[model samples]
Structure formats: structure tokens, C-alpha cells
Target chain A: MLPVATGEFDLIRRYFTGLGGDGDGIDLAVGDDCALLSIPADRQLAVTTDTLVESVHFPANCDPALLARRALRVNLSDLAAMGARPLGFQLALTLPSVDVSWLAAFSLGLAQDASTFQCPLVGGDTTKGPLTLSITLMGTVERNHALRRDGAADGDYLYVTGTPGDAGGGLAIMTSGGERHNQYLLERYWLPTPRLAAGELLAGFASAAIDVSDGLVQDAGHLCHHSGLGCTLVWDQLPLSTPLVDEFGVEQATRWALSAGDDYELCFSVPPGRAAEMELAMAGAGEQVTRIGVMGRGISGVSCVSSDGQPFRLEQAGYAHF
Target chain B: MLPVATGEFDLIRRYFTGLGGDGDGIDLAVGDDCALLSIPADRQLAVTTDTLVESVHFPANCDPALLARRALRVNLSDLAAMGARPLGFQLALTLPSVDVSWLAAFSLGLAQDASTFQCPLVGGDTTKGPLTLSITLMGTVERNHALRRDGAADGDYLYVTGTPGDAGGGLAIMTSGGERHNQYLLERYWLPTPRLAAGELLAGFASAAIDVSDGLVQDAGHLCHHSGLGCTLVWDQLPLSTPLVDEFGVEQATRWALSAGDDYELCFSVPPGRAAEMELAMAGAGEQVTRIGVMGRGISGVSCVSSDGQPFRLEQAGYAHF
Candidate 1:
């Protein structure tokens, strides 16, 4: 049971209602049973849902605001992976108990990110329960133009954005000892940018794309699973963040780069001849990516090869929260 | 940590992925980053989110299939309140452990409702945590056709569909000693129908609308608050089901009807001039309603009037989760 202060706060009106935009596409906002939105008839709506539970998906005592930002960023990454532009979002948050300050900090972080992402909080629900945040992000894309996982063909080159696995490095440092204040790694972990521009750009060039959440290898395996093909990763070409490499060493960094989760970066495949044009388009967009593998036929799943072209084995794939 | 058996279940592919409609308006169904939906150009998308947590919202040992149906039906009630037609839904479930039989029953209930309501299951997430379920239901309505709470005017007649307090009596029976086996009361509590037809009909005639989740008085208060008016519910006119009255008597049933929560029936305001035509339309639609009150200006919040025209005092308004 929560303290009576929970009711005194009037969470919907006091906190959640004022976070979104000034009624751009929203015909109605919070306080109602349903929020109505007009998505220009030319575009199709893209929706995704992601949930984070305390002590399961995240540290139990993480900063509330940072947790809020991280939760939203991860869900937004889903839309980014789909090449969908921001529309709005609905949050269904379950809490064990209500602490005014904790709620204040949490809402502040949500408001901040909601503004940054240009996605308003169209509606939401708050209930007393174990602490968990589930966000169903809604976005829009041109009709029939969404980047899908099954579109990539054999021989398509696999590409990844930013240096992957810095988030896992951050997690390792945070859990290992008193190095939780490592700014770069922690920022990467909690606030990995949702590559909206890159996703929208790639929608036209990349045959298929997905954001790196469940580690590079496992997530690529998802693409292979969906596309009915296999992929080979050039072990030496996997991008390793400089900070991660410098702190954890190349061996540890490579392991994190390939096998750790929470990387919020895009992984896509470019058709052979379209690579040059896609790269050229991406150069000026401030989104850097490295070609790490190529999709091929007649294989079971994702395989990796060292620079010498010898098969490399990854001891474990990635995290699964079941 | 959850049992390694959770990983063994592959909850999404096995249970959730196959619950939705047969690829209608769904470009990509379960595995993708976002569920792409092609909402017709002439329609506006109406969205709502609802969550239920174990121990707080329900008994710890409620039947899995019934719980799943109740959860989804309650959320669908919101869509009905808005006069929206069902499109699809997303479920984010947090489970303490993976039970194969429980998952099977829960998904069966969800699939049943998905077919019954014509709302497909578009996507979902399953995670390890204290048991909780969050659903975001999406639907569509013609532009400017949504039945909303802000449209009622002073002097409008307040009407409610079906009997309002049966669910409350059902809950009372369940929580008191050993009346849980009372089929009529328990069924009313667990399987309250969403007044979709009534809502769609009301959209064309009612001034304002909301579904009864927080009891009659409080939900009517919501309509008043949003419409910038006050409403008076005639206690004598409050609809009480025969089963509830049979067990609890008239006085007790009146209290439950006016104050207890979890009635999925719709409470709406109809303009004075449209009552006859509205009632005629409702008659042919096979939906029955009772006019219980009237909206007025200058009075704050919800007031109750006895049969003799004196103010009737209600001990409590409704349930509030904090």
C-alpha cells in the first residue's frame, strides 16, 4: 500500500499531463480514457512496447531521472530501428510505493526526455505494484516504407552504428566497484542516442535494420532468423568504443562489443552496390557506422571470423530477461 | 532471478506472437522493432493504456485465463468509452516465474478476447519481475467523432448502460468469507461486458461519455469536471442488478451501485432535446440504458438527490490507486 500522499499529488494532472507538446497532433491528452491523435493520413503509425523492471533489467537503486531517460531511450530505439519518426508515447508505470521526491525526479527525467525526443506523453497509467516502467512508443513512417527485418538478402553487408557495447562496459564498472561515476561509459549506458536521422535515412537504402539491444551477435542472429539467411562477422572490424577499449583492454572490449547488451545502436544490411551511396549519405548526417559482416545463404545463424579468416566462437550470446 | 526455464519458454514467439488478427493492417506483426499499422486516412487513432498488478489489483490466486480476460476487457472498455472501433493491442507482462500452463491459459484468454472484440494482438514484451500486466489498446474513429468527456453541456441528462453495481457486489461476495462460489456475482465481477454498441450509438447523440471503472458517482464527477459542469445522480434511479439486489437487498445494492468500482458499463450525458430519439435508437440497437441524473452549472462536483428531492449523502465516491 502507498502513503496517502500518493493521492494528494494528483499525478495525472500535476505530473503526466503537462509533459507533451502544445497540442500539435493531439486532439485530446491526459485525464481522458483515450487520447485521440490525428496521424496525417499519408503516414502509417508505428508502435512498439518495452518494459523495465527493478532488480531484473536495471539496478534497483539507479538514479530515478537517469532511469527514466534510459527507459524512454531504449523504447525510442525501437522506433529508430524501424525508421519511424516520433509521434507520441503512452506510459504504464507500476510502482511499489509512492515517494513524492522519487516521483518528482522520475517525472522530471521523463519530461526532459519527452521534450528532447519530440514525443509527447499522450496518456498514461500509474498503479501501486513492483516498480516497473512500460512505455509503448508510437511513431509514424511513410506508408509501405518502413525498414523491416525480412528485407535483407544474401550478400548484403552488415553495418553497425557507433562503438557498440559501451553500455555493457558501463554496467560492468558500475557493478564491479566504486567506478559508477565514469561519465562517458555511464552516459553511453543510460542515454544511448536513438538514431532517428540515421534510421530514417537508412529506410530508403538499407534492406533491413534493427537496434542493438541484446548484444551485436544475438541481435544479428535475430535479423538472420527473420530474413532466413546467415551472416559472417569480421571479428577485427567490430567497432569498439575508445573509452571501452582503453579501460577494459581490447580482449575484454571485444567481448563486450560482441556479447553484451543495452547498446541502443542500429544494425542494418546494405545491398552490395548501395553501400557507397548509403555511406555517402550517412557521412554528413553525423552518424558513423562500420561494415562488420555480410549476410549469406546456407548457414544456420550468425558466425564470426578472425582477421586470418578462422572461425571464432563466442562463449555466450547475450542477455535474456525471461 | 527467474528460473532458467523462462529462457526455455521463449514467451513471445510461443505465446504472444500468434494472438492477433490475420495480418490485417499489420505490415509486420511480432518480431519487428515496431508494429507497423496502416490506419486508414479517414480515421483518427484512439489509444489508451491500463495496467494491473498482483496482490494490489487482484487476489493472488485468481484463475489465469479469467484474469487475462478481465484485464483485456477492462482496457477495451476505455475504447468503448471513446466510441472507437478496435484495431489491436500490445501487452507488457511481468511474471515472477514462467509457468507453462498459466501462459497457455492466459494467452488463450487473450486470443479469445482478441477475436471477440476484433482487436488483434499486435506486439508485446515479457520480463521477469513481480507479476503485473500492462496493455495499450489502440483503435480508430472517424475524425471528430470520438465521444469525449468534455462535450457535455449543462442541463444534459446523464444515462448509464446496463446495471452499474453488479461488479461491486461480486467483489464484495468474493472478499467476504466464502461467497466466492456465487456464480452470478463472481461472473459479474470477472466478466463485465464492455458497452461497445452503446458507446458507438452514444457518440452520435450523447454530449459526453466515460465508462464506469471508478463507480458511478466519481465517474460522473469526471464527466462534470471535464465538461465544466456539475451533475446530480438520482439515487432512486441508479441501476442495480437483480442478482446484486437479491443478495444484498436494495439499500446495500444502492450503496454499491453509487460508490463501488469496476463496473465496465458506460455513463454518458445526453442533451435534453435528444433523449427520445436517442432512446429509440438505443432500443433498436439492443442496448438498454436508464437515465439517472442531469448536468447543471454553478454546482461543484457530483451531487446526489433522493426520491423526495433532498440531498443524499454518499459515504464514499470511488476507488483511487496510488
Candidate 2:
């Protein structure tokens, strides 16, 4: 059973007001007609918006706290891909009914993540509807230094941070009930960490970057399409979690890495001559940078090849909401 | 019947990309991980988000084009209240299924408003869900010059721009079907003009301001609550439409003006000495500015009284979404 909401204003005051401190870049927070934000003079604002619907983005009975975190994290991932430092976000949450306990847990999770990422809740609207969460995150990047998808060159080397297929494997586990007790996998599905630090470090070194939300290959194809180039992803070089490899064989793991979605890891391209320097920089920052593929001058798509130079046929490219 | 959407990406490319131009303070538009925005050095960003859900926010079968316009206009009204100049907006649209005709009409209405307000479409997300539209609008105001609700003084005279309760009367007409042929009231409900020019003019003169969204009396109460003051509104002073007076009678029209919501006009307070100056300023700007009441140093709430100084009783203060 869900707790009843007392009223809209009361709910917002109780659950959202203290989500984060107002001092960072927000001149004014909630309770006003609009929030006043002061962006640093040297930085440009990076803005993105995303929406998640119940039963479509997650299971119907999923934990509210995790749902809130996922909703904010996915949007933060977009900022990370653009090499922007998270500043704050506004939430538009629609609920089927006022559920006090559900809201309490959800707000607690949101507050925790807001604190963790230093992205405060600035302003938002709460309305009655089918359960849905929409977040618009704002960040700042140095003028002309923000990473873009159309900057990849013909000889750019593709690199990815973190394992690509773990979230998909986690989703598969949750859906199939094959490993119901796999907490790691469940955590991967519910709590994706945006690669903010890695992206920031790669800002000057990377030619093009994108966060892997719609599977590695499909998103790589997006990068290629924007850059007017193609890519050759080495199947053996694809990163996979130990648990994913243990549960699913090499072939399945590779397939998930290429075709499954919701990774939330940064995949970027570096100029061929700067690959070694970029790797050193990432290593110095204590982040993993994996060499995954290379951009080529060809049709805009990703071609997968095995270690022995054999072509691998993928069943599907990635997940599409439509 | 609704038309079918070709695909998500294709639909966005066809209908939404051309919604606004790229040069108006937008460094990067759509097709990127995040849109980049450049705020003037002397200005602070004013951000606000609002969500509209089908059946809850509007009639279930409301026209898609009208729905889109209402969604954007309501958010723009918030900017007006803040005395901010419109810059750009991000949209998160969720639909139950692909509806090509609906999307085309919706995007057309959205584009028209974006162009009219000079608030371009910066970024957005589209997902599959029950029909919902969430828009986060961004604007700019000179630092420390934003009109706030907490700035009213004890001796401030209260004022409003345009007639209040017209939209409520419009809504009443739509609900009862008594005057389906009343195009004026129907247009009032479907399309509200935000008092941008008036709000901008009020920035330096008005002590505090707010958009009359939750009825004139209730929203005035909000101003009082923020300013730690009280207000006494002259019941007969409220501006009412001629049609509203003719259809609902003077008594009910007075009640609607006092308690019915969705006016979307600016309600503000001016220091006692600035009333004439404000009137002159507004006259110069060719906008209506009506003096309706006065702020007082007392318990916080709106007190309504008739022309004879007798207290007026209201059954409900305002509309509450919950």
C-alpha cells in the first residue's frame, strides 16, 4: 500500500526543500516562481532533459528511491557526455496519487544523489498523473571546450570508460529472474554512475564523446553519423564485467556489450597521435580508459570484428523506446 | 484518428528541429548530447519547469495543438512573473503511442509560441508513455533585479495587469457546454498571453509580483505569505470580462474573479508613492494596470470586502491540484 499525499505544496516543502544547499550556483532555490542561477562568466550552460515512465523504463513495483536516483543519473549522464560539470537540475514528477511513504523514500534517494553529485534541486512542478519522472539537468563547460559528437577525425581512436554491457546484463537478470539474488547486477541496473570526472579529464584530449545509453554499437553509430565517418569495433577489446562473463558465455557477453543498452559509460574518440597521451592522462586521474575501436572513412555505421579478424553478425543494434 | 509516427529520430528531425533558430543565445541546438547556452555576462539565468498531464491538467480529448500551446504559455507566464526576458526552453514529451498528426499539430503550436516569444527550442526528449508534456524554460534577468514575491512593503498598493478569472469563466463554459459557441471565452482558455512587456516594465518599480495562476485572492495570499504581510482587496475592484458578467451574473462573476483560478495575469504590489508612476509607466507601455487593493502589516491572508466596507465570504480560496 502507498501512503496518501497530504497536499502538493506540503509534500514539496517536506520532501524537496532540503535536497541540496542553495549556495552553489543557485541564487534562489524552490518556493519561487523561478529559480535564479548564476553561471560563471567563462563557462557556457549545458542543458538536457529526459523522461522516464513507470513499467516502461523500470519495473512497476521498483523501489521509489532507486527510481528517483535513476531518473536524475540518466540525465546527469548526458552532461557527462558533453564534458560539463553538474550544477543543478529541476524535476517534474507526476504521481498516480500522493504516496507519502513512496515519496519519502524517493526524496531520500534523490537528496542523497543530489548531494553526491553536488547537483542541487533548483525548481520543479509536481502534478497528478500516471507515475512519471522528468528531469532537466543544467551544467557548465568552458566556452568552446565542451566535447561534441561531430568532432571525430578519420584516424581518431575510440575509447570507452568502464564496462559497457554490465547494465544490460543487470536488466536481463532482473527480467529473466535467472539470478534474482545478484545484487551487483541489480545495482548496476538501478544506479548508473555518470562518468563526470573522466569526461572532464578527456575534454581537451577527446575529439568526440557520447554516453552509451542506447548500446555501445548503436551509440557508436550515432557518433559516426554525426562525424560523417564509420567505426570498426574490436569484439575482443569490448569491456565486460567479471560477473557478466561468468553468467553469460563470451559470445553472449560480447553480444550484450554490442547490442544491449543502458550502459551510462563515456565512449569517446581521440586523435590517433594523442591516444597514448590521453591514456596517460586518464591513468593519472585514476580512471580506466579502454581502447575499443577506430573511426574510419566509410559508411556511417559500426562494424564489429572478432580477435582473429572475422566479422561478427549482431542480432540487433540496440534498444529503442519507440 | 491519429496518424502514425515514422520513427523517433525521424520524427524529431522532421517536426521539432526547425522549431527555433540557433543564433538567439543558443550556442548549440538539438542533435547533441546536451545543448549549450550562452547567458550574457550581466544577466542571471531564470529557470522554471512545469508539466501538463492529460485529463488532469486538461480535458482528456483536448486538441493537441491547443494542449502544446497551453503547456508552453503557462511556463512563459512564470518567466513573466519573474520579470525575466525569454531565452530558450527544453521539452520532454511522452506519448502513449506514435500519433503523427497529433505530433505535427502539437509541434506546430509549440513552434509558433517559441517564435512569438523568441524563446527557442534548445533541447528535448521524447519517450513512450501516457500523454504528458514537461517544459523547462530558461530566461535572463539582471542580477538582483528579479521581481520576487517577498519584497512587498506594509504600505504597498496592490495591482494586477489585465482581467482576472476570465480563464476560469472560459473553463466553466467548456465544462458546462452551455456556450460552446463562445469563441472569445474558448480562446481565452486555450491561448493566454503572458504579460511579458508589463512585467519587464514592472521590474524596477513594483515591490513584488506573481502570476495569478491559483486565482487572484489565493495568489495574493501567496504574495502575503512570502512578504510576511496581509492584504485587503476591494471586492468590487476586481476586473471582470463583460461576457463573464453577462453569463454568470455580477455575484458569480465577482466570486470567480476572487476565487476561480487560471488567470495567468500579473498580480503585483507597488509602494504607495509609486502608484501614479506605475500607472503612467503602464500607460506609456500601452498595458492595463489596475489598482485593486493595499498591503497591510497583519496576519497573512487576503481579506475581501465589498464597496460598503462589509466583509465578503468565499466558499473556497483557490484551486489546489491535489
Candidate 3:
């Protein structure tokens, strides 16, 4: 529910005036014409923006609270890639009509996330239009410590965090799957946990890192192509939850793992010898880091292999925005 | 017009990629999940964002090129309030339907203005939805040199640049007013000239500043209230072009100046001692700077007055967003 007949400035002040998340490096927060932030003396600021529209990015009847969460989390995923710590963010909202109740829930959800993440809401604008959200997130990383897509080296182990396919499975449930399956899967798709902690930890250990928004296979291909390397993926070794296998057959789960989207997981690559140390660090942080593949010198594409070394195939390809 | 069924990534690359305007501070441009910018060692970054919705901010059938200009210009105006110089910007565009030709025209207009202002496109997002555009602009200034709304002092002269009522008149012509009377007004309203140069110059001399968006009197009230000062505006000296007066008569023009909105001009205050030097600087730059009022020690409010210091009543107030 949004506020009807509420002016732009009042709406902003009532819902977004203060989250008080700024510290150390943030110089100024909201209230002025523009917010000001500072990069630590030896660091650069990582920034990314994303827009989500009703019926395009999510179902038309999507929950307002979840929509806000997903919108912010998607931008946070980009920050995760750069090994940047969340500092602050700006929001631009467009709505078809005002519904005060909806807005209250949305703002409450946004406020909770901002508090939990410690990223202040620095600036934003709201207008009347089809429900749309655009968020720009800012983060910081030490100079030269930011991860690059083209930095993966040959013989590096490709790793991923958490289970894959939960989000895709969730989507499937949404379209008429069982009550049990739908609830679990819907939660995965609607409320993804961004891998900020894992990403920051991997900054020094991983050669390159990317967040998996598209399917794992497609995203891995991006890393490989950018890094000028080929990858061999171990299908049997993929990390999957028991529920995923029980809800869908093993083959279906594997296919979803390969081609499903919206996992918000981190996929990265590190040298072979550093894998053990990285694993220990991830464990210490309670992160579920899984080694799924290895970067190779000669090939330029990803090859998914079965336990017997046979090539794996899927009927559906990864998601494409087109 | 926007592209038809354009894939999301391709649309972003086509419209927003490679803009790296004013690259001296850009650490990374588009293509990665997020962008990285290196804040200058001695300057602080000023950031603001704005969103414009079709049939809300502008008429539903407004020109694509003009709409694009307005979207960016409005955000730039916010930067001007802080006396920040243009740096780079990001855009988020959403459309109800794809019209390739419209996209081409809109992008061309945006690129032209971006280049003209020396502010390049740094990053943005595009998605399918009702027509809406969001822009976040970043600029820089010497540390603590930012002009804010809280610094106006008693006895300061309240000044404005260019004329105030043209755009308001144009808006009247656009909605229900006669075409002959509205032609010039509409043009001014649709294609506002941002007070970039004036703002940069005034940054050094002005005590405080804000852009006139909600009409002269309303915006003046904002400056006064924010700075905890009172303003007495000389209605007789309110700037009006001869053409406007001839077309709508002085009374109507005065009404428009008082309450009409959409004029992207600068309204600022300066100490009395700097008035002469400020006028000289503006004249040397071939710009129009009008001294229309004065700041004084009184309750924070705006009042219209005659040359003889008699209070005057206005027929209309500025546009109210609510």
C-alpha cells in the first residue's frame, strides 16, 4: 500500500529520511540535494544499478516486501563480485497508483534490510507510474583488491557457494507445483541471501569472481570467455539440497542446476593449492563453498561431465534477457 | 519509441555502454556486474537521483527526445543546487512497448546532452514496463566547498537567473491554453536550459542555493525555511521577458512566476558585499542574473512586496506535488 495524495518530498521523509547506516568512510547521508561518500584512502568505490519492473522481473502480483528485498539484493550481488563492502545505496521508485498500506510494508521491509546490511539509504526519487524500482548500490574495496572477470588463471579451481537450482525449483513450484515444493522454492526465488561475506572473503583468494544470476553453466561460460580459459565441470559433484532431489528427479535437479537462474550464489575461481585454505576460511565463516569445476588452458567453453566422464546435456538452456 | 522485444543485456550495451564520460576518475566502466569509480583525492563526490514517469512528470505523448533531456536535466539540477560540477551519470529506462525508432531518437538526445555537458554516461539499466526513466548523476567539488541550503544569512540578497515564468506559461499552453499564447512557453518548459555555469560561478560567492522547480515563490520559501531566514520578494522586479508580458499580460505573467513550475533556473542568495562582483561575473559570462529579493531576520517565510516595501498578495501559489 502506498500513500495516496502524498507529495514526493513528504513521502521520502516519512519513509526514507534516515536509516543511520553510514560510518567511517561515508561522509554524508541523505537530506541534502545529494549524498556524499568517501572511499577509504587506499580503496575505490564499486557501484552498480539495477531496475526491476512488475510483470517483467517478477509476477504482477508479487509481494511488495519481497519485491523490495529482491530489488536491493540483486544490486548487492554486483557488489559481491567486486569484493566491495556495502556502504550506501540510492533508490528510484515509480508506481502506477498509490496504496499507503503497500508502501508501509515495502518501506518497513526496506528499512529492515538496510539496518541488517548496514547500508544506508542515501538518496532516492519517487514518481507515479507502473510499479518499478531502480537501485544503485555503492561499496568499497581496497585498491587492486577488487575482483575482475578476466583474472582467472589456468588450472584454477572453479567454486560456488550454497546450493544451486533452489530458485529455479522455486519458480517451477510457483507455476502449479505442490504446496510443499512451492513454498520452499518461492522463498528461494523471492528472498535470495546475497553472498557478501563470502565474496569479501574470496577477494584475496579468488583470481576472479561473479555472482550467478543467470544459470551456473551460462555464467561460468562468461568467466571462462573473459579469462581466456576453458572449464571442466563435474556434474556429480554439484552441491544440491535433499529437498531439490526429492521434489524433482535427480536428472531434473541436475538440469535445473545447470540452467536455472536467480540463485544469487557466488561463483569464483582460485589456484589449486589455495583451495584447502579457502575451504577452511569459508568453513570458519560458515559459508557453503563447493568446488564444482576447474579452469583449463586449452578449451574455451564449459564441459559438464557425468561421474563416468560422459558429457552431460540439458533440454533447456540458461535464461536470456532477450 | 523504444526497441521491440529487445533483450535486456543488449539494450543496456547499446544505449548505456562505452559512455565513460570524464574518465579521469572512472576506475571501471560498464560490462562488469558493477562499475567502480575512483573518487578524486582532494574532492568529495556529490550524488543525486531522480525518476520521471510518463503521464505523471510529463504528458503521455511527450516527445521522446525532450523527455530524455528532462530526465537527465532534472537530476543535474539537483547537483547544481550543491554547486557541484557535472561528472558522469547512470540511467534506468523502462518502456511499455518497444519502438526501435523511439529508442534511437531518445538515445541520440541523451548522448548529445551528455557530451554537451561533459558528463558521460557511466552505467544504467533497462527493462520492460510503463514508460519511466531514472537518472543518478555524480559530480565533485573541493572538500567542504559545497553550497548548501542551511547557510543563508540576514541581509543577503536573493537572486535568480534567467526568467521564471516562461516554462510555466509553456505548460499552460501544453494543457489547455491557446497554441499561439503557449508556443514559446511550451518550448521553454520542454527544453529548459540548466543553470550549470551560473551555479558553478555562484558556488564561490553565494551563501546558499536551490533550483527553482516548484515555481519561484515556492522554491524561495524552501531556501528561506531551510536556512532559517525570511525573504521579502519584490514582486515588481520579478523577471519576465517582454514577449511573455505581451502574450499574457503583466498580471498573468506575475501569477505564473509566483506559482508555475518547471523552470530549471538557479535561485540563490549572496552577501551584499559580493553583489557587485557577482553581477560582473555573470555579465562577463553573458548570463542573466536577476536580483529579485532580499533575506532578513524574521520568521522563516516568503512574502511578496512592492518596491516601496508594502506587502503584496499573490493570486496563486507554486505547484504543489501532493
Q: List the candidates' TM-scores in order.
A: 0.97, 0.97, 0.92
Model with the higher TM-score, candidate 1 or 3: 1
- Candidate 1, residue A235: Cα displacement in angstroms equals 1.4
Model 2, B1-322: lDDT tens digits are 0111236777777888958565568998888999999999899999999899988989887888889888888999999999999999999999998788998899888888888888889889999999999999999999899999999999899999987877887888899866455677677778988888998899979999999887788888888888998888988988888987877788888888887777789999999888898899899999998899989997347888876887777778888778
Work out candidate 2's RMSD over C-alphas: 3.6
Q: What is residue A17's positional error in candidate 3, in angstroms?
A: 0.8
TM-score of chain B of 3: 0.93
Ranking by TM-score: 2, 1, 3
B1-322 per-residue lDDT for model 3 (tens digits): 0011226656666766765355667777777777778778788888899888877788787788888887778878888888888878878878776677888788888887887777778777777778888998888866787878878999999999998898877887777745465567777888788788888888889999988887788778778877887888888898998778888898888888876788878889999999999999999999899999999887448878779977656655676454
Error of 2 at B12 (Å): 1.4
When only the first chain is scored, the TM-scores of the models are 0.96, 0.96, 0.94
- What does the lDDT come to for candidate 2? 0.87
Ranking by DockQ: 1, 2, 3
In candidate 3, which residue ranges exceed 4 Å CA deviation?
A1-6, A181-184, A296-300, B1-6, B20-22, B176-178, B181-187, B309-316
Q: What would the C-alpha RMSD of candidate 3 be, to one decimal place?
A: 3.9
Off by over 4 Å in 1: A1-9, A179-181, B1-9
Residue A210, model 2, lDDT:
95
Q: Which 10 successive residues of model 3 chain B have the least lDDT summed?
A: B1-10
Please give the CA lDDT of all the candidate structures.
0.86, 0.87, 0.81
